[model samples]
Each structure stands twice: as C-alpha cells, then as structure tokens.
Target: MSHRFRKPVNIMPTPTIDLAGPVAGIDTHTDTHTVAIVTETGKHLATDTFPTTSNGYQQVTEFLSAYSVVAAGIEGTNSYGAGLTRHLIGHGHVVFEVLRPTRALRRRDGKSDPVDALAAARQVLTGQALSIPKDTTGPVESLRMLQITRHQLVATAAKLLTLIKSLLVTAPVTVRQRYATMTTTTLVMTLSRCRPPADVTDPVNGTLTSLKSLATTYNMLRAQCDELDNKITDLVEVINPAMTQIFGCRAVTAAELLVSLGENPQRIRSQAALAHLWGVAPIPASSGRTNRHRLNRGGDRQANAALHRIVLVRMRHDERTRDYVQRRIKEGLSKKEIMRCLKRAIVREIYQVLCLGRPVRQSSGLRSDEFRALRSKKGLSQTQVAKKLGCAPARISDIETGKRRLSELKLTYEEFLKTA
Candidate 1:
C-alpha cells in the first residue's frame, strides 16, 4: 500500500485590522507567546496568550487590533520571538528588541508572563527598548543559515574524530596496532574500508564496526562542510566581494560579519556602533584616581571571533599590520592591547566595505565575463587553461563563471591569456 504524504501549507495572513493607539509587548516561548497591551500612559489594557504558530501569530495580531499598536517590545527577536517579530514587522507595526529584566527588577515586580509582557510595553513607552531587530529576509539570512549549518557539520566532524581516536585507545591490540598511528584522513579511510562481521558479538568486531560507522559519518560530514564552503564563498562574493577580498577576511569570516550587520547595514549608524556590536569597543572603568578601560564582553561573539581571526592572520601575514603591532608593542601595549587595537581598525575597514559600499576588487583588471571573453579570444578552452595552471577544469570553470575566487590563479590566468 502506498500512502501519499503532502506538505502542510502556510495560510497567508490577511490585512491587519486597524484600531486606536496603544503600545504592545510579547513574552515569547517555545510553545506559546504572551501578549500585553498597554495604554500610552503605561496602563495595562489587556493581556492574552497565543500559541507560537502561523495561526497563533495571526490571532495575536488580530487581538492587538483591539488597540492600535504604536510599538511592540519583544524579547528574543533572533530566537523564540523571531517569527512574531517578522509577522509584526510585515504588518507595518514598529518593533523594538527588549532586554530580559534584571534579577533585581524581577524580584521587585514579581515574575509572570503578563508582568513581563507589560514590562516590555512599558519599556517601549519609556523609550528604553530602542534597537531595531535585524531584517532577516535577505541574502544575509541565507548566508547565516549556510554558516550555521557549516559550523554544526564541522563541530560534528570534530566530535566524530575525537570519538574515533578514543575508540582506538580502547580498541583490541591488533586493531590498534594496525590503525592507530595513521593521520586523520588515512585513519578515516582505513576504518571506512573496514570489513567487520555482521554479528558484533566479538569485541574486536564490535570495535571495528563502531569505528567504521563513525569514520563514514566523519567523511560524510566533511563532504557536506566542503559543499557548504563553496556555497558560502559564492554567496559572500555576491553579497560583498570587497569584504572577502580584504586581507584575512575569507568567505566564512565575511559571512559572520554580514550576518551580524543584517540585511540592512545602514541600520548600524557608525563604525563605533559596529565595533560595539562586535564587542571590540572598550568600556571605561574609571574611578577617582584610577582610569582604565576594560574589554567589552557583550555583542555577537561569533562576529568577535571572526574579527579575532582577521587580526591574527593579519598580524602574521600582513606587513603593515605587523609593523603596527611592533609600533604598539614599543608604545607599551601588550599583545592583548595590540589585538584590540587591530580589531578596532579592522572594524573600521569592514565598515567601509559593508556599510560604505566599497567597490569590488577587479580580478586582473577584468570582470568575470571579460575574463571569459579574453580566454575565448585566446582560443583556449577551460580544460586547456586548467591544465596549463595545474588545476582541475571544474575549478577553471568556477572561476570564469564567478562561482569561485582564486586571486592568484586569476592573475596567473591573465598572464597566460596575454602570452597566448
């Protein structure tokens, strides 16, 4: 018997019902969301709970129509409240991201959904919650999803590698002697090709079977990660090639920055704001006699990590950066201080590329299409070019089609074209 399975459809929300003015707030959770409507003067008008779903979001909007929502304060605009935030924004209601109430505040006010919701509303009315949530309906969103998946795949592969090594430690003597000393790639390949008995009653066979399964999983995840890397590179190139072209800013790093900036980069007012968002901005810890700044520990940690990577790479490979590091060290700055300064400078450069919209780097003074035309004029096929360059033909095709960016290869290709 064949059973046909159909996908569930999303019912599009209708036009929002209009009403008189009031502010709203929502306390969101995994299964349900609590909504509190408050008047202009901070008086609670109504409180209601709705399921966290398409229909529930729609109902919440309808319920809010009882009073015209001037602004809605929502916690977790990037997590549990994401769907509702999008729904509210799509319906033309202004939304503000509300921070969680502090423990002291919670203790004073008493904790409850209605109380929290009203707090959010009151925060908005008082102009406390001011941040506009990231607009996720853009290419940056796609990059974020890809980056997240790639991070998970890499993490899973790492764990599998660790598990495989751990298993080998306790593996049978013969098995350990046979496979333990190989490099990761070799070990995975050897284990993946292992032929253990179908019945795993024997300890040796059980270990071998487990190793084989884990090795295979590791290989699969690695392949997925590679595929995702290609996608990320292409997408980041599209979003802002200039960003990726910056020294030490690869596709993954660029994607992290773009995700943090969101689709609407303009919303990030200045380089200082950008630095603050990446947690690179120093916080003043001044007193009557002592004046010092401390490292900021807030903002998107992933973005901060990306900045750290860029600073590290530049410190190693970039001559100017190295010179700056030395100069800072001579000026009584420690390695940590040097890194912080570099991160701030890097943020400024990033701001120029992402927010100021720097022009994309020209590959050997030609666009992808122009480069392809130049190759055609030279009467050389992609395979011929790839062979001459000692790379795969697919790589040549990807570069020519703008699916990949190999700066060195492109320069070499340009020289080859000129000679041909």
Candidate 2:
C-alpha cells in the first residue's frame, strides 16, 4: 500500500482537571465585582456584587465566610482587583490569581459575565489557571513600587526625546537652522532665549512651555526614580550579593530577580515551572511528520527581559557561554536556538546555585548527599554545571537549600505546557 498520511488522534480531547474543593469565582472590575460561589458539584450557590471599597470588602468577607471557600479565584489580580485580592489574601484565603478567560473559552461556551467568572474560578481551582506572581513582603512590595516609578520616569524621558525628534522632522527650516540639532537641554535653553522671532510671536513657544513643564516634571520624577534606584541597589546588594558575583548578572538583572522572587524561592516548586514563568522554556508542537517547538511568548515580560539582559551580558563577556554559543552554531543550531538553549541551561544553573548553600563562587565543593544526588541526576559535575550556566559553583549551594531557585513564579497557559 502507498504511504498515506493521516491526522493523528488527540489522545485527550480536553485538559484534565481534578478540583478538590469548592471554589469562589470572582470577576474583578475597577469599580465593582461579580462573584459566584461554586460548589464541588459545579453548582452556583450564590452570586452577588460588591463595590470596590472597604465596605464592599466587608460585604464580600461576610458573604465568603458563610461558605467553606477552598479557594477564591480572581481575574486581573495585579491590576484592577489587586485591592480585593490583598483584602482576601490578608484574611487567610488561598487566592488563585487567574487570567481572564480566553476568547476561545468564551466562544466555546458563549460569553456572559457569569460564564467568565465561573470559567476563571473553575480554571484556577482545577490547576489550569495555576496562579499569578505577587509579593506580600514589605521589601518586595517596596521594590515593585520603585520599579514602577523608575520605569515611568525612564519612559517619560524617552518620550521627550521622541517628541524632540518628531518636532525636528516637522518643523520649518527657520526653527531647524542650527537649534534643531541641539541637545534637549541646549534646545530648551536656546528656545528660552530666542524671544519668538518678534513678528511670529512663536506659536511653538506655548507648545515649548508645555514640553518644558514636562521636562521639569521629568527631572523631578528622575530624582525620585534615582532615590528608588539607590534603595533597590542597596536592597540587591544585601539580598543577592552572590548573584552580583556572577560576571554577567548585573545589578538590574539581580534587582529584577530579587524583587520578583523575594526572600523565598520555594513558592515555585521546580526549575521547569520557573522556566515557564520566565517565558524562556520551549514548547513542543508535533504531530505525525510535522515536528517542532516554539519559544514561550507567555510569561512575566519583565522577568523575561531581565533574563535576556543576562544572556546578552554573558554572550559579550563570559567565555563559557560564548563558547557554548559558538559550538551550537557549529552544530547547526540557529543563533536564536542557541540562545533558547542557553536560557534553559540557565535554569539548570539556577538549580545548582540554589543547591550549594554558598555564595556564587566559580567552584564550591558539594559534599552533601543532596548536592551529589542533584549533580548525579543531571550527570554534570559542580564546575561543569556552573560553567554551563554562567554562574558560580557556590551558587549551587543556595539551589540545594530553599534560599534561591527561580524568579517570577507564574506559569504559562499554553495548550501544550505539561512538558514545560
């Protein structure tokens, strides 16, 4: 018979979910929320609304207290419903911070507020939603605030530069004459001194005033940002001193991991799980003759960015990482594939770092049973693993203990994520 390709059967038509207990479904909004109490039997016992305020919080607490809420699942936990989540979590609630239902889910069942809420709650309760990453510690919370402010200030500064460029592109030659190429400060000063060219009265001067106001505010924000940066820097030095010792792991990468992972890394159970959270893991997509995998595009973009920075730094300075890339190139893997493998290998490095119980030194002895087991299982000696991961062998110590693991513990919601 001629070879005939046929569509492979999907072993499982759907994802498996074995929810243990009752779950509360909450659809969070800026001003109001829709909450539904769902029983293990999949019945909605109660549905109600609460204002996004303290009194509303009290109302929710009273309502939630009546039922044995195994877990409360809320969408937008990081943004609109953050206050509500904090309130619930503060009251000893296991809050499953779920992503909003996908359009596929909505279309699959048809859309409605109730449907969305139920999907979110059930999704999380079933372990499909997993959870979002958040920090309850004071230092981590402070670091997050600082990062937000710093990022905002930097973005504003970038916008100012963009505006200056756009202005030059559109301005007439008279304005463009010599002042166009001036630096922002120089341009601001020159414009301040020009006096509107008399007859024209400088319509752009009014615009310039607004831009200058933005610049002044930008300066204030920059100062605030600088203070925050200093505080974060100090915090990183104290918390992740070993991470700083790694040649390619700069302060920014260190800060991101510190703020993202906080003092505890056990919150994320495994390095594989952590890789998904960092958006560095690859997912296989294969059926019959077609076989391929793709880099995960879902995760904390911020943490992913930090990982990229580390990789870039290592590529430039770390001989081991550079050589690995070169070898991978010789082996016929594309540059992107080489980087992806390096990133996953970083997870292994993270595992080793957390295992050794020492600072991030190039080589640290691993005499403990745990260390031996880990190394034996991976089939790499301490130094070999350290070199591959671009980290110190001493870091392997922290990886063994609960001191460190991976940053940003949120997993992706890919269709094929079990391998990850």
Return the top candidate by lDDT. Answer: 1
Compose the digit string of candidate 1's lDDT tens values, residues 121-166: 7877766435778898889989999998999899999999999999
True-vs-predicted CA distance for residue 309, candidate 1, Å? 1.0
lDDT of 2 at 367: 21
Which stretches in model 1 have alpha-carbon errors above 4 Å?
1-20, 360-420
lDDT of 2 by residue, 1-420 (tens): 011223322211223344566778888888888888888877778888889999998788878888877778888877788888888878877776676887887779987667778887677656664554364545666667777777887888778667755765666565566666678777655554444433335656544554455556656666776787788787766665676676577666667765666445555655666776677766566689977665579876787787777788889977657656886788788887777777777655664454233555352223223554656665666666556556676665455452543232101111111222
Off by over 4 Å in 2: 1-21, 166-224, 259-264, 350-358, 363-420
Question: In model 2, which range of ten residues has the least summed lDDT?
Answer: 408-417
Per-model TM-score versus the true fold: 0.78, 0.70
Q: How close is each model in CA RMSD to the real structure?
A: 14.6, 11.6
